[model samples]
Target: MSTPEEVAPDADAVTRFDDLGISGPVLAAVRDLGYETPSPIQLATIPTLLGGRDVVGMAQTGTGKTAAFALPILERLDIAQKTPQALVLAPTRELALQVSEAFESYSARMKGVHLLPVYGGQGYGQQLSALRRGVHVVVGTPGRIMDHLAKGTLDLSELKYLVLDEADEMLKMGFAEDVEQILAQTPEDKQVALFSATMPAPIRRLAQQYLRDPEEIAIASKTTTNTNITQRYLVVSYAQKIDALTRILEVEIFDGMIVFVRTRNETETVAEKLRARGYSAAAISGDVTQVQRERTVSQLKAGKLDILVATDVAARGLDVERITHVVNFDIPTDTESYVHRIGRTGRAGRTGDAISFITPRERYLLKHIEKATRQTPTQMQLPSTEDVNVTRLARFDDAITAALEETARIEAFRDIVAHYVRNHNVPEGDVAAALAVVAQGETPLLLNPDDDPLAKAVEADGRPRRDAKERAERGPRTERRGRGDYAPYRIEVGRRHRVEPRQIVGALANEGGLGRDDFGAITIRPDFSIVELPVNLDAVVLDKLQGTRISGRLIEIKPDRGRAPRREDRGSSYDRPRRGDDRPGSDKPRKPRHKR
Candidate 1:
């Protein structure tokens, strides 16, 4: 329940894992895992944790914080006396399983060491049997840990180390009490290491009450996204997403890739679409069996699979070295998920590319993500038709070269073709051309791309452009009479909620990041309200407005479906202004009575 003051390190002393005095077996396993340089968190926290001091590490998600405390625990554990020497608590079952898997990987050379993951929705018999057989480390969620403790099945009496991974997320999921109960069961002398992306007040209080003077190590998140990654996005309407994604897959050269979607349904749909286009693709989600998930991931790692379409939950903690790109088929709902989505690539110090498909209305989310990650994404325009043709032909050439390599005896066939040309008294070029036509199957070898619509209708920024024909067909029309550059949007708040125009405008300007000039009209009805906002609003601005409150009511803003008609569709002050009038007119200037 208490910790001692942290032992401070000497100034300006830099050390590697080897210099930090890690055991030979552990260091060997680390090197075998292909990690040469230590991350900043590892460099700062490893020495202290190795020195048997309680430590608190603050770092972003993909910063290799796992190895910082994991290695020290591995080095300190006695192989023979395996009665749960260490307990690493994670927030979710996925994270717990990943942590245990990592321990197994790092302890490859450490014989007789067993790490078990205990979490909810899993059988107790396996965990109980593993305990009976004596496990060295137990990684799990707090709820299951507390269950074992209450049942007197887990022997934390012999536990020497405790780790709280992602403490803030744990607290958010209402595990604070369980964590405290579990901590109280461990020996007071146990070395506790807490790592969180953020140190919220509750976690700070928990640390203050539980951890002895802990060494504070904070690694500020980078001001920008990983420089090793080339980030770009494609803007297309929601309906055109599949076509756009197919075109990009045709143009981009990659080894293996993961395409992230938002829903379980979408994972299958996207993967099927890619498969129909001849991609070796698969879909994964939480609904799949563990065996299926493992097989899918194994296929991805072994280069048997080219594209994996998955939802975030199914893809958590997946580390595959062959992953060359991560495509966000649908933008993540939040920035933290976005960071983790891209982190699947650009690992092991290898340069990677991350592409996303966004609609025009969703560009605001791009700006929101940019402010969150400190990286401005460039839009990838559609590939030119000629460019696509060239790429396809090059692939065809590669296919031909590979086929020729496999057909070592094609020389005889070539001689026969030469004999045929001579006998027919035809040009050799003409004979070769006939063979190519036969080999091309249904698709032509040299396609004329001049008729491609995207050649002229796609802008550099991925936005749609009108061609001359379309522009000529849709003749010009007069602009709206009132509200310059503002479009009518409806909100749920209304006269029933005592909504007011000034309150709506104030909320839009202050909470929605809109200017006063951007608002034009506001009308509150019995159950809904309509307001005007500048056209082409920023995504962040729209999101903020959607969550804004006036009179303690949520402003769920959506495009006005041509505002509901009233007896006065003939004359509403906010709808439109009359000619020769400086302002909109109403038949009844005095506010009408409400039904409620």
Candidate 2:
């Protein structure tokens, strides 16, 4: 195995499929699929890969990396044989299906070619049967592939080419060990190609170990800022973020929008909330069916849907040119993720917009994002009551103008208004006022100021104060707590695993059979966070709380130290928001954590 030096770009590499050296059948498939010139990565890697050489290509997502490897892999396939010869491993099930579809599209002219995508959360009987029946290509995740290999259901003994798609993502998802174990089963002489957006240390080591003197191709990242994309953020409370998002949706002129949330639960919740507010929004998460995910994305691309709320993992390889806005409903956890999220828009030289919602406490994360992007995100002020009213009236006016311009028959309505004046003997001004009221009623003009809670709250805080009246009777508290007695426990996880105080508090309150009030003073220092719980609580509760998750890590909740550190007593320490330091806001207050 040897490493090939960087090769100069083939003159025709950037050309359209017809002009490129791709065969007649491949050209026909490309034409039918309606794709034009090759993307940067595709231009650089396709030829090398087609020549039966191993490849290590580094390119960002949505840069047509799929075709970079797929086109070449399909070109080398023997149409007569239906045996599994090539295997592709993707990080997620969504991408596995996509890669399989790409194989089908690229090999449309090949007779007796079969490609199967096998992944978890899907039927195994069908996959086993497909493998037995004969498939030219197999795409799957690492874990499922390992399972198939162990079951003797997938045959890699005759495998000639292996592709690790999105290698970096697989590592991040804790699939590094599974990937290495699966790779050990492939034939020693097989051609290996690895592609990733970012080359972390582990991936670099893997490539060095696996690839035989492979050709290295690195497509330079698009470094120039997309001036066409107007990036901005709105500082709003967590409770008011949905309202803030609704206001922007209502007022902004967008062709299509993708709203990203952190969790799968939030994707559904946010989508449902938008639907209740009358927005044509859909949700896409890992739990959704393949058909549902396809339908949701297809609808958005076809102009039938206006907004899609999706998680980062679920929205991979999503390329829709009509998407005009990308909303970070929840700030992305890292800089690279933020880049990918915003890259969905401002395509084809069309101007786009990305707006993020940052809470006061999370403002520091926003600053980090700005630094990563090398551009400050403009702060978006809440829409004032006057602004909302003005926009509402303008919409009404636009409707009237549209009706007058487009309607062929307005004489009847005009005559009716004139007739009303004559019959009622009312002044012309009064009749016009009545007509305006009726016209406004028929329009889709939602002018309630409080509909935007953030705006309303800001406005309320600005005005004269009003005293609130206490309820006649106190409502029942959710949980009762003991004042003095407190129990303590410790978890195995520490700062290395990224555990935080709130995560521990939430985990304990929800899983430990401890009510909100049952938790006493909480202290989170370096390594671990200590929480005070009711002493002598049920042994069953203690047993359950032990082995509970603090921050995605099982903890051993036991006893705490006698002397607890007070919150105000401790000097201000480093606080990193969940969004990481790469979000918005200024980094004025950040300091590196001090080591003991």
Top candidate on TM-score is 2
Give the per-residue lDDT digits (tens) of candidate 2, residues 243-280. 77877776787899999987677888999999988789
TM-scores of the models, in the given order? Answer: 0.47, 0.49
Off-target runs (Cα >4 Å) in candidate 2 are: 1-21, 34-36, 125-129, 198-201, 223-226, 231-251, 254-351, 354-596
Candidate 2, which ten residues in sequence have the lowest lDDT sum? 464-473
* Residue-by-residue lDDT tens digits, candidate 1, 262-346: 7677899999999987899999975789899999999999999999999766788899998889998887534556787888889
Q: RMSD, each candidate, Å?
A: 15.2, 13.6
Top candidate on lDDT is 1
